[model samples]
Target: MLFAHDTEVSLRAAVALVNSASEPETMRTTADLDAFFAEHGYTGRHTGGADELAEVRRLRPRLRTLLTSDRDTAAELVNDLLRDAGALPRLVRHGDVDWHVHAVDDDAPLAERIAVETAMAMIDVIRSDEMSRLDVCSDETCDGVVLDLSRNRSKRFCSPACGNRNAVAAYRARRR
Candidate 1:
């Protein structure tokens, strides 16, 4: 694995959150936020409502910058995030997951928890010199983040849909 299982999960969640803000936004309602939280297996105080949803949505741009920045800049951004959140890392295991780090209290606001977790995971990526694993989507029409976790580091699109679209376009061009 490129990183610990929990670290990879956190990074994937962060990428999904960032991509949700792209054109044709997928997270436009409280229900969307709830689904996101559930899908990511987030265990914490989740006050479901428009205000909470807005707070989470506001994190996208900052996370995108962190994910796409150079290694040094990404480290600086992660440091800033951890400092701003007053993060204190500790090991915690809940549900089916094994022991892993949780850097914020369970009662912390969902946005803060999400941010701090993403920042903490980035710590591993930065330290391991795996910043190349995080990248902007290759689809020129989409401004989404792509996490290349494949063994060969061959992932180049944010989603299968984008990859298929580009492939179809290439095939058509070849036929012409």
Candidate 2:
């Protein structure tokens, strides 16, 4: 794998979080915010509260900006994330896992943890020249973002189901 297992997980989680912000003008709500974080398995003891939920909602657009940013823009944002929250690079192992870098501080707010973790993962991607692998979906009708990890670097859809569904539709249209 290009990164450690947890790093990969964090990157994908970032993509999912970004896509959740791409909703139309009318449908985003607090419940929608809760559902987005919940689906992504974001766990925090006190993050179940409303203010925390609101912070997650606020982060959505910022994450989305990262998805479409140029390398310079993304680097700036990554730096801001790290600097704003004082991310420290510490190697840590907990819960039976092997040692890995923890950019997050234990006392940091949930959003700060998320920002630092995501920024640290982006640091890895940038150093490896793999930042280009991060992408938004190519489905003309959907704005979902995705992390492309294919061996051939050819992924264009956020989900396989969306890829197949759209492909079949295109095929039928050509046949008709």
Candidate 3:
């Protein structure tokens, strides 16, 4: 794999969280946030309140910026996030997950944990010189973050929807 299992998972989670805000905002309610956290296997304290939701929403743009930034800028952002969160890396095993790094307490604010975890994962991306794996969706109309985890680094679209859309358009163009 290009990165550690936990790192890849965290990176994908970060991308999904960022992409959920690609349009007007898919995560508009607590229910939406809950669903997202459930899907991402986020295990921690969640306020299930407006403030928590708002903080998560605020973090989306920052994560997006990191994905689209140059290596130096992304590195700086990651370091800042880690520093800001006062992350203290600790290896922990929970639920069905194996031992992985948890840089903050489980009871920490959900947004802070998310930021710290994402930043820790980003360190692997930067140190491995694999920042190119983070990209904007190739679809012109979609502003989603694409995490290219393929062995050949060939993934260009953020989701199957965009990949299929582009494929269909290409086929039609060739037939013309």
10 residues in a row with least lDDT, candidate 3: 19-28
What's the candidate order when arranged by decreasing lDDT?
1, 3, 2
Model 3, 1-176: lDDT tens digits are: 87899998899889989998977567899999999889888898988899999999999989999888999999999999998988899999998889999999899999888888899999999998988999999999999999998999899998898999999999999999
RMSD of candidates 1 onward, in order: 0.7, 2.9, 1.1
Candidate 2, residues 8-94: lDDT per residue as tens digits? 877887887776566443216656556655655444433456787677667777877775677778889999888888777998776
TM-score result, candidate 1: 0.98
**Cα lDDT of model 2 overall?**
0.74
TM-scores of the models, in the order given: 0.98, 0.85, 0.96
lDDT of 1: 0.94
- The Cα local distance difference test for each model comes to 0.94, 0.74, 0.91
**Residue 124 in candidate 2 has what lDDT?**
76
